[model samples]
Target: MAVSLWHKKVIFFGGKGGVGKTTCSASFGLLAAKRGLRTLVVSTDPAHSLGDIFATHIDEEGQLAPNLWGYEINPVKESERYTEQIKSQFQNVVSPVIMEEIQRQIEAAYSAPGSEEAAIFDKFIDMLERIETEFDLVVFDTAPTGHTLRLLSLPELLASWIEHLIAQREKANRLMSMAAVGSPELKEKTDKPDPVLATLKRREERFRRAREFIVDNQAASFIFVVNAEKLPIMETQKAMEILVKYQIPIGGVIVNRLLPTDQEGPFWTRRRELEKKYMAEIEEQFGSLILAKLPLLPDDIYGRQALDQIVQMLEEQIID
Candidate 1:
């Protein structure tokens, strides 16, 4: 079968926690790398297990196999770096008094709840921008469904938000220019262009580009991993709705950890029956989007050898 994901530049694997998104992502990366495609598997989940699964330590980026790299985004580190970058941009542009006040406000904003998400989104953009340059395919192992949904929606949300900020900044700059009309030196400073306004415009454009890249069906796709269980099925349904709302392309759904059909005994039979019910629901709701169904493995999936099993399944079963 032709691999559908092979043609896409960016792909995301997301679902409820513990449904095996990381395994699927790593397996896909392994398969892609073995195919001679340069693949980078990045974990956006804060509670990262990508390193443990690969049996390798990956801080920013590390080679796991030939042509395959892994990166676990550190929110705290990225947040600190993002804050410093923002602070650096303000220097030599504003007076000392305004700079100090801006620094204080920035520090305060750093403590806000969504700051880490914002920082991670910036890093996410960086990874998306790296496609076809440093890597041929970028696979994201995202956080749980809700958190991942929020993260995916950032480009849309921030695009408009940044545009508004740019508009306000432009208005403020116009007023400053009007006030500076009396002094030639002040008018010269105001007419030259506002650095802050320029920065806002740059940010607006960046978010706009990110938004465009994400919504492009040919370039990007999102795969959701779900177990044939009640909560996972429900959460996956809701998450699919959110993705549809945002116009992010849905690659397909992977039903993971399915019970073995050959198992015997009353407990096994009962569990299979329960799974059957949920499986039917899955079919009814997501029939067209089903990509692959992975059975529960006998051994823990760690290291490249274990991952190869998953890769084999994906290689055989993934629908285009």
Candidate 2:
């Protein structure tokens, strides 16, 4: 296994289900922390396995080890945070009835198909903004390939929608102003356009900045984690294409659970042969973008010592 070539950039691990993405991400986070980078690893999957990998009980947010923080985002929590912020800002301008409506809307948004992805995107943005001054790296243990692609592509889609919303808000402001002079009904409509328009404008700016930050190579990168299997390989290829379509930088691919070449026996030989064949295919498909191959250990990789062994494998490569 080789070492990674990129540091500082946010590394994302994604692949098919049961591909050991959480383990690889946890190992990488440990490596980064050992390098004194002040790393944070986050899991976006609804069925998060980071705690299992670390062999530690973790709350929504916890420090698994020194210089290493881990989090499993609860969309409900994020929705509440956003709701509170919006409520506080718009309390005076929006009536109590409208405020309650907005709260319902926010909850609905969080439960919607894309709301969880949006919440994760918001958290990533918050991390990026803070990492600029506080941390050196952030590793994301993303959900399976399908979910990760959806999550990563959200910024672009959200940016377009927000742009439209901003434009609409501006138009609404103009309409309200013109109508204010017309009648009593119109006057009520335009009376408090300032707060609503201002809130939308601020949110639009935040989304735009976050979108730009994510697509920028210096700020973020996507790494696909896969095992040497037909399904995982095909899934990784599809994910790579989707990531490129979204303009997210491809960091590299991590091939986990590779059968070791040593250990003399018929079963060992057969397993090695299969792994070598698949390894060749992976190399041909991904080329130099293949970053590391983690050998399958005799037992499950867990706790600090096993994590250190994984990091040792990573450190052997030359990270460009």
Candidate 3:
């Protein structure tokens, strides 16, 4: 199928830490960009390595390259953005005291286990909605598999909550408007309801739209980057199950750092032998979905030259 059906078609790279997810994501974005598509590589991991892979400095916005752009989101900056939006939308309806309390609550919420992940997810969805018009493809270098699953699952969880909030707001609005022209008894009943309900309704609508953009497969897809190691492979399998359970679209998997088995001598022979063993397991487990295999390079994978090699490797068919 053509990849264009996905409005935003985000390819997320996620797996066990140290599995070369950032390098793979950068290579994919570079390849897409080289093919004449405007591509953006976004890094959501706290310890971002996209900048290192691209050999360029990136901040919250982005830095331009030949055909690709890169961005490393700062959690503090994202938290500030979230707070500003909440304050602007609720300033008029919420009392000053209530607004202060809400700000404190939001800060507290950000410290919770999944708070940062949720904030990053919201920023990603916001970027996809607003800036997708400027780029043909968006590649995300996500955190480890565990945190990435939490990020992907946020859309469905938030969708249900937003639907309930919207319903409650609709009910409140009808009652409040009726109170404006009805009898004194009715007016008294409506006046007691909190005015913040209207603002809440608007917020819920925005969240609903974001959720739709995420769950719509035509707009998003996830790619798991894994190695041949036992732990990494197990984590990838578990991650696949979670993504499928959430109804998120799964793209082909990228098996990174595969050893070339056609070399001579004992050192090369042992390396090749070990690789063959894991390669067989990988094929048996995910044969139908393997997209690319990247061989382990002797030097560090960074800069345009190295990235180009990685791209070429990704484009080649895996040899069984």
TM-score of each: 0.97, 0.89, 0.85
Ranking by TM-score: 1, 2, 3
Give the per-residue lDDT digits (tens) of candidate 1, residues 130-242: 99789999999999998989988998888888888888888888898899988999998988877898888888888888889888888899999999999999998899899
Best by lDDT: 1
Q: What lDDT would each prediction earn against the true structure?
A: 0.91, 0.79, 0.77
> Global lDDT for candidate 1?
0.91
lDDT of 2 by residue, 80-120 (tens): 67667766876777789998888788767766776656666
In model 2, residue pairs whose N, Cα or C atoms come closer than 3 Å (at least 3 residues apart or on different chains), thus clashing, are 3-317, 5-320
Tens-digit lDDT track of model 3 for 235-282: 999998998887777776888887766668999887777778888888
Model 2 residue runs over 4 Å out of place are 1-6, 182-193, 262-269
Which run of 10 residues does model 3 get worst, by summed lDDT?
1-10
Badly placed stretches (over 4 Å) of model 1 are 1-3
Reference-based TM-score, model 3? 0.85
